[model samples]
Target: MSSTGIEIERAAGFVKNETPQIVTSRFDVEDSHTLVGYLATGGYEGIRKALTQTPAEVHGEIRDATVLGRGGAGFPAGVKWGFMPPDVFPRYLVVNGDESEPGTYKDRLLMELDPHQLIEGCLIASYAVGLSQCFLYVRGEMALAQERIATALNEAYAAGYVGRNILGTDFSLDIILHWGAGAYVVGEETALIESLEGNRGMPRLKPPYFPAAIGLYGKPTIVNNVETLANLPWIANNGAEEYRKIGTETSPGTRMVAVSGHVKRPGVYEIINGTTTFRQLLFDEEYCGGMLEGRTLKAFVPGGGSAPWFLPDQLDLPFEASEVGPAGSMLGSGAIMVMDDTTDIPKAAHSLTRFYAHESCGKCVPCREGGTWLERILGRIIDGHGTTRDLAMLLEVGETICPGDFPHASSERLGLDAQRFPYQMTTICFVGPSAFAPIHSALTLFPEEFAERVRDVTDEELAASAVGAVPVELKGVAAQ
Candidate 1:
């Protein structure tokens, strides 16, 4: 069991196949964070083998393996590396360690328990991409992870694994450890680059500011998630074909899923990608060990807090991006938050909206103003001061942020339908859509819960007033 009372279990025959533990392989070994301990478990061997081949060869290997980014976007790491404009000198590699998504703790575990593995992965990536320097940007709240990585860096530097002609090869690189001030928006690649350059951590607009083309300090930059790069050592040691055999064809190898909420055993589990289903993850004894006692599963946040919620109907869906994306959610950040029947839907939606509102950097007007507006409306409903108009306003505000048909669970109770996943966004980043996700999901999935808390207004009154037009009753409620 972990410190949070969540039991971390290894992947077993829940899928009738033995899942290979890649990143979390050394997590159980004692002193695994140390160079000596890592060496005993064959650490740094990947870099040693990587040095034997040319940079292009190592790059091709990763591209062939199809290692998707584990942070959230699920972009292939090699394809991202290939975007670096050729002949560009002084290219930098930024490892994103800002694991700030709610219920997402897999990167922190990887950094804290096996720092050496991350370093080795960085070394391999640096060599393959010809990066001049590397930056490991960890979240500010992860002090233990920062300490472990810092210690590992010092050990690596002293032992010649990092810096100056590593392993007698022409490659020389430096790994710098930098931590943020706990801003959630910095998890975005361009936003993370802004923070690294001593800015306010706001996301940069694409087209003119894609990180691969024009990034930190106006040069080429490749920002990969910690988990994405951590898979490098294994891909380097074992052939890509061998790695491909573990999971499905589209999503090969294993992924670390951090499960939380009402489940009995709710910790990180390395399950073979695309093979496991929500039913196996939540009910299988090796995974979440089923919902708490007699409480049946109500709903779950499929991919971190930002994703649209999923109901019991999605239990049998495979935990794959292709399947989940078409099912009205994503396997984003590999974070699964379970909620049982006893959960309060309105309050839950209010809690998540409040987080996005508080974390908004105020860069985009839709996210800055509209997100807070949505939060206030949800809170008012939760506090028993909301009117029927508030429900219409919630969807209206969400539509402004995510224009067009928004994705939501089936609302058969009210005869209201929803579109599929991947809603259109007006903001520069997903933060605006994230703030509205819970509202859309909760209202669609469990409309009765919200209706019970709100004061029903006459249809004539609702039709007479326009959305967002604060009436006398809501004036004081909105002010509060």
Candidate 2:
């Protein structure tokens, strides 16, 4: 394995000890965005080589590689590709570029740092999935990245990597960038396809409705995350065995982790999957530097924002979706959000609940109404104005959003706690179980703080709102 030659910093980057040069192939390129610069590196070789082979051959290569979707679900990428039917109408390899999930800046990093590599990955995927066209549905706020990718597409066409008869071969592929209006739901494959097709972004029902069976324009389509596809060329060129050498048996290859929270250094690092534990990432970052002095660790938001929080006791857990799930959380999108000692859990839950409420598109009544109620109740509780009954009410709201085992009424759970009186039931989203984690924990762990809030003490007596400097997004990645 190529030892990632750069000097390791205390924190930053997606996954630590990332694949030496797999995704980041041109850190030193002069004007890395320019065509000339890309050509200087081994840019279009994968596409060039792929064009000479049959579509099935390329598909076979990807299927053999066993790359799972990096956007959180960890679905098998090859299986998703194999699902695409043989239709010439307009099969699309939709690139899910909506980076709205709180801890997922890795796609932005890849797009900004090496646009060409991503394009090549797009081309290969398009070819592998028998797509004559591909779409990169990027988050609307990323205007600069849109322009960079547009420029790269133009250059790729000029050099015959895109457009008709690419690279002196019989195959042709074209990639276009589709800008999103910006919604977190758009990260879901069907929702993304809907937004790309100019509709409000909301997840479509499944079954007679798989994206590969009937997708955008009512044709078979396959949507893959930007990072998942970006790793394509490397796998195609280097072979599956080469990619498999680094990570565990099931989760082969490196995973890009967007590490934020209390640590010495906070940034994105690419690590071999299952190679690092939660403990190392949290306590070791020099930038964020563990939790602030007196503060102890609180829950962590693993995966994307929707994933359950992991308490400090779960620190030894492996960092993979399958592994994290059994522990009652998900390793969603590789975003490891660390909460420090002084953080108020209830307030934090309220903050994220508010984000979901604002972004819930309203296409569906449950998510729309449920999210709003969740934020209101949780926010009230965090502000120290809630009764203990309000805690049960919060759980009711959490149930509204995340109805268990998938019942229709559950999904549409916008029921209220008690329209009649005190002895009634309640309604809600994950914010309930969410509110309890911090609220209950505070009641026990920091009883005095909860007591002050409950007794209507002065603001100074309220748990000081876990103050710390939040990292800023500079260009592509999050910075401390």
Task: Give per-candidate clash totals.
Answer: 0, 32
Per residue, candidate 2 scores C-alpha lDDT tens digits across 1-480 of: 116332334533533343455776665454887778877777777877777778788888888788988987788799888777666557878898888876677888778778888888898888877786889888888887888899998888887878888777777877888888867778878888888888887777656445887998988888899999889888877877888776787888887777776654677777668767777767755223466556677667766565556566567777765666655556768887777766676666666666767777666565677667767866676687765555565556545544442111000122311111011112222222332232333332333444444433334323332343332223235532
- Superposed by TM-score, candidate 1 places the C-alpha of residue 237 at a distance from the truth, in angstroms, of 0.4
> What lDDT tens digits, residue by residue, belong to model 1 across residues 42-130?
89999999999999999999999999899998998999999999999889999999999987878998999999999999999999999
For each candidate, the alpha-carbon lDDT, in order, equals 0.88, 0.68
Please give the RMSD of candidate 2 to the true structure. 11.6
Task: Highest TM-score: give the candidate number.
Answer: 1
Q: TM-scores, in order shown?
A: 0.92, 0.81
Among all candidates shown, the one with the greatest lDDT:
1
Model 1 TM-score (2 dp): 0.92
- CA lDDT, candidate 2, residue 397: 54
